[model samples]
Target: MNIAIMGAGLSGLACAITLEKAGIRPAIFEKRSQVGDRFVNGEALLSIFTHPDRDNIATFSDQYGIYLSPTSHIQRMELFSKNKKAVIEGHLGFSNIRGREQDSFEAQLERQTKSTIKFHSEETYEQLLSDYTHVVLAAGDGAYSKSMKNFREDFTVSIKGVTISGKFDRYTVMSWLDYDLAPFGYGFLIPYSEKEANLSIAIPDIPKNAHVHISDLWDVFYQKVRSQLVQNLPITDQFQITQYPIGICNSPRIGNTYFVGNCYGSMMPFMGFGQYAAILSGVYAAYDLCGMGNYEELMKPLRQSYENSLVLRKAMEQLSNEGLDRIIHSLQGDWADKLFQSHRINPLKIASYLLRPYIKLKNE
Candidate 1:
């Protein structure tokens, strides 16, 4: 059976290897002349990995010269509204290195893959429809998957985001909390270097042309930086400013063509923990196409493991919002602080307010 995998990013390459392990040699086709350019992997955020094997894999920086930090330890985060005026802490999260580091991984994986990787300079969506029996579209961003109109009707997935990264101690490790400083989205202050940090803002599924003004978000950040945090990086230091749009794909996971990876729907909504999810999806796609009866049996534990991951994701989203609300409420004074502290710590209390599910489960 001839299998053609599309996009050599994390997802496509992973699928190729899985297929090779199954005694099938798949061909990888990348629209770019090179495999790793469109995809980036330096200081890429991996705030969202719960997989058991997550710690086992080496980063691209391990193979290539790019700077990639391994999973050292999970750090607790602190949220402060305008410097030390109000501070909140005791939250845990993680981030993986992305950007150029990711490109290096793809390059290395291409060499490690059992199948042939075809970097077609003139490759377009039209040719992909013509040449393969089974084509797994792992193409990310607007270029590839947007061409498939049917995909839109199936899922409600969109993201509006902003990110900026600069010299902050040459990619130092630190705790960054959502300043809760933005109106439309979340604000991020990434400590990249000792003398510089990137301030980021992200909104999920906001209109492309919304007239929402965010001068206030920066105003808060400006004042905060002028205070104690200023010692780390002043507000006037050179900074990287960017807009990042993020969303989850509401589409069904399996289909006729097997839309996988970012193409299937962002493996992660702006959290940027896409690499591993892409690799995992590729593993699932290979099992589907391989058609070995035992593959499904083999996949049971894998799916179960990832399903828990999905559960954790949903839970975290709920927790984040609740935590944000509690922080906002607590900033007023000690009475509110004591009341909001528990909510800040465990934001998923909404599970009790989940209407029928909780009631039914409770009754059960």
Candidate 2:
């Protein structure tokens, strides 16, 4: 079967690699000159988000024959609210570099694939459909899916981030949930190494946050990071994204065309963690194409996770600073350990179910 995969990002590359394993070398197309050709940033793979299977890298390698090396294992995570701070330590997850770096996840995946990618190509979906038997749209975002009338946009987020040079604990990641600094948004610091990290904030687009200027919020967040870390981190590079869509596809497969990655709505609405789900979507799509499995059936868990995360996101948006402070304080001791370290408990699902009534009440 002739197949074409769009956008050589995480999902597209994963799909290509999986297809190759099944003896199908699908044609891959990338709009950029190379894979991961964008701003460099640090991202986390939280074990809580990918429960039942901790150590995502190992899971990928062992289960799917996809090997990836993380920049560092996340052993500690610091959560800061407006009035309280909590530290949770253990085998949290991992931190990996994203974008143009040679060791980035995209580069790692690109190396594993034997399929040739047509880089710098402006092949549109409509154009590819006429040439290939099946087309997999993994364009790294929901734009193409939305254009195809297959995407249901839940929300958009404004993000501003920078790569800073500073002393950092590569295994520790920090996050801020203070509304004064980011409104209904959150700030994070994910270190790529002992001397470099990506500090960023993501603010959801809602009416209450309509007047929130990201630059102003960023200034506050930067100062907070400086005070908390007690370092004047020098920014080496910066990037800004506005109205970035976070949503899901109505269906994983529509006709012979498949949606994967962010295009498939693998990104969770709660904290935007979906690397595992995104990779799985691609592999699942490839499996469906090879007549090994059904794409829709494989994506059920990911879709459920998205729905759960959306519920939590709605609840979080309604919370006041006092509420956030209480939540952070509650995560201080044994509770934090149980919530983060326990493999049996899916915190996202539990939290979503518990907060559903509260969310409904708030909405009413």
Candidate 3:
């Protein structure tokens, strides 16, 4: 069966790689001139794959023939509320993958596909669907949202960050819940190396009572976190910032078209980490096409996890500053470990917890 994949991002590349491994070469189309250029947050460290049950990131890379390098292993995060702070430690880990560079992980993986990418191809989604036997929509930002009926848009996430030249604590990732940095989102620091790190904030685009743009959000982030965290650290001239929309889709695939990555809401709702989901979606798609596995069956666990993340996100939205402070402080030691590491927690229970506030309002 002939297949066509759109976009050269991680998901698309992963899909192509898997198909090539299965001896079915798929045609790849990328809008960008070079691989990884379109991905706005490619440099940020991803941690979910570091779990013991999961393949060690290095091993996974070796097994899949993708290039991924270890930067720093961070197992703890320092969370700050307006008044209180908490330190939660667990299996949080990260890797360094530079975007657009030749040595970057995505670039290396793209090279392995050995397929000619129709760069700057102007074929519309409908046109591609008509021409290819099967089309994989790896292009994110609601690429096939209108075509699919069950697609529900959640919100736009604005990612703003600057590289700084200074020593960053490689042992921990930092986050703050102050309203100033992000009225509806949070600020973070992910160290790329000991001397250089990406200081970024992911906030909702349309925040209540705020007329905010990407530039304005960066200014607020600088004043609230960067100014304090990197006191004498010089902000490098090279920096990147962008925004993308994310949502959940009940029907990711219909007929011959498959939706992957952000278009299918593979990102974790809590912090927007999606590389794992994106890659997995693509790999499973290849397997299904080759009649080796069921894509939906493979995605069941991730779908449930996404639902759980949404439940937590809703619960976080209702918290007052003081409540947030209390919750942060309460999460410590074994409690924090269990919360972060335990995947056995029933998502249904969390969903019920999120509904309690709304249920009470309906009764009143």
The lDDT per prediction is 0.47, 0.92, 0.69
TM-score of 3: 0.85
Total clashes for model 2: 0
C-alpha RMSD for every candidate: 7.9, 1.6, 3.8
Cα lDDT of model 3 overall? 0.69
- Who is ahead in TM-score, 1 or 3? 3
Which of the numbered candidates is closest to the native, going by highest lDDT?
A: 2
Q: Which stretches of candidate 2 lie over 4 Å from their true place?
A: 360-364
**Runs in model 3 with CA error above 4 Å?**
39-67, 147-150, 206-214, 237-243, 342-364
TM-score of every candidate relative to the true structure? 0.60, 0.98, 0.85
lDDT of 1 by residue, 1-364 (tens): 5667778877787778778777888877877777666423233333323232323244333422223233233332334432332433222233343333433556656766867667764566567657767777777642344555434321122222223333443333332334254432454544433444445444333343254445445555545544534443334323232333223333423344766666754444323446655665667778778774342353444334333333433333343545655655465455433433343332222322343241322113
State how far residue 243 of model 1 sits from its true place (Å): 9.2
Error (Å) of candidate 2 at residue 230 is 1.5
Q: How many residue pairs clash in each candidate?
A: 24, 0, 0
